[model samples]
Target: MGALAQLLPLVRSARRDQDQSVLSAALQAFLDFGIKRTSMVEVARRGGLSLATLYRRFSSKSDLIQAVGLQQTREFIEGVDAAVQQQIDRDAGAEAQIVELFVAFLDGLRGNRLLDRLLDTEPEIVLPYLTTKGAPVIELGRDYLAEFVTRLQAEGKLPAYDPLPVAEMVARTALSLALTPQTVIPLDDDIAVRKYARDHVAVSFRVPVTDS
Candidate 1:
């Protein structure tokens, strides 16, 4: 079975913008005092709500964190989808859209307060989530990339090989690049990053099609 079959099924949370403010407050709490140090009370205080109100919404700290994660995943996917659509509207080429895949990911990740703060101050805390405990997030990325790959292959921009493995590679690499600060890839340089993505990461997903 391919990775897509192993992909986690994403369900849109019933909680809408009303609870998003609470999630944002919780995220701020995590940013201010790290995940371990942040508490439900702090989230409630930051959100300007009573502790009972907070607990009424999120049963526990664990529940709150999971909600925050689900919300973040939605935001990340939405941002990437818009970027891809913008690229297409501009009549960008296949290579350009492929470049946008990696480009849009890291670009969206840039200046993410929680992510940057966590990596800078508490690598030990977040590294595991990005690596070992990463199946949930990775599966989400895998599904998105796999869908994109299937479309590209249908358009004859990619080979007829399976899209799941290719998507997994791209997804995993994209996540790794986002989390890890040290790399020869030169992410600090936007122009260089796009060039590297177009020439390297994008190319790696496409296999040679032989005359059968």
Candidate 2:
């Protein structure tokens, strides 16, 4: 199991009512004022706790940020899982399902107002969380996709290759498109973006054509 798969249970078990309130307040403050400007004192006040209590829960701003990011990542994974299941239920082919999975992931990111705002105005605050300390989230996503790919292989939809490497490629490609779409292709239209992913995924993972 990856680090994220291990941490998910811990994250679930560690959440108390007080901790939830603190994290909620801290996330709101960060969204409102950006990470650098959001102080622990303000978080405490917003959470209706004393500075000492807040500090006891989260020793510093970075700790609180990590907690918030982890929670968000957990939610994102859940949402993506649901979206992928829905697409599978639609009886789409394996390749189309993969494309839909990424489309749903992209849509989830686009729908998050706070994340979008941070990316727009305070990208610096968000970039490090994704680039420097983002292994947990990336691993979580990769593991989930790996499981999906394994299932596809069992259904004979994809070839019986190692799923982990392919899952990693899918995760990395999705993240790249989400973060730096302009570097890859124009994403001005949703249909075009989905087509692009579909084409790329098909070409990358398609079965070999052998002459009879």
Candidate 3:
């Protein structure tokens, strides 16, 4: 009986993986051919599945887009955690470590096709997820920043401040700059943005910006 139960979960998980694969393919098709241009039949074709199968998993295109956006957000947070772990293991300086993790998070978002489409081409799909108070993605970002800042303060790397509140403010400010139309931060200008984020951290913690 226990073996049967374990096997049942594995079977359910496999089915779930298959469903996600179909959805991922549909998302790629949507990215390639805009939301309005893509159709359910086309997505199924791109996914190498039957229309019935696709519709069974995602009732509509809008639903699929939302799922992809949420998945992207989850993956992005995981990437940020990995980057933070990597930086800490290397004993990176406090400010440098924070900026590195922040940049990694931004980079992950930039590479997300669903998010890119929503941000750059379809504001209708993007605005709700970003603006909503209880949105999962926004909440994850806020929580991650708050935790990181708190850790820094606890480690004596940063001054004792209310990390959650400060991190929330910083996240909001950064999001505003990034999401604003016609305002692009070129991370490629490597030194400048790095210096900018680092300096902001220094000011926030009331620490001197060191010349490294």
lDDT of 2 by residue, 1-212 (tens): 24444445555445888888888898899888888899999999999999998887666677778778777766787888888777666355677777777778887776776677788888988887777777766776788888887887777777888888877887777777667756655456678878886767655655333200
lDDT of 3 by residue, 14-65 (tens): 2466766765776687688777677888888877889998777676676666
lDDT of 1 by residue, 1-212 (tens): 13222222322434556577798898888877898899888898888889999888777775676566656766787789898788665344457677777778888777467778878887887776667766667777888888887777777766788778877887788777778757888788879988787668766776333311
Better of 1 and 2 by TM-score: 2
The TM-score values for the models, in the order shown, are 0.78, 0.80, 0.68
lDDT of 1 at 105: 85
Error of 1 at 34 (Å): 2.8
Clashes of each: 0, 0, 0
Shift in Å, residue 181, candidate 2: 2.9
Question: Can you tell me which runs of candidate 2 are displaced by over 4 Å?
Answer: 1-9, 12-14, 87-91, 183-186, 203-212
Top-lDDT candidate index: 2
lDDT of each: 0.72, 0.74, 0.63
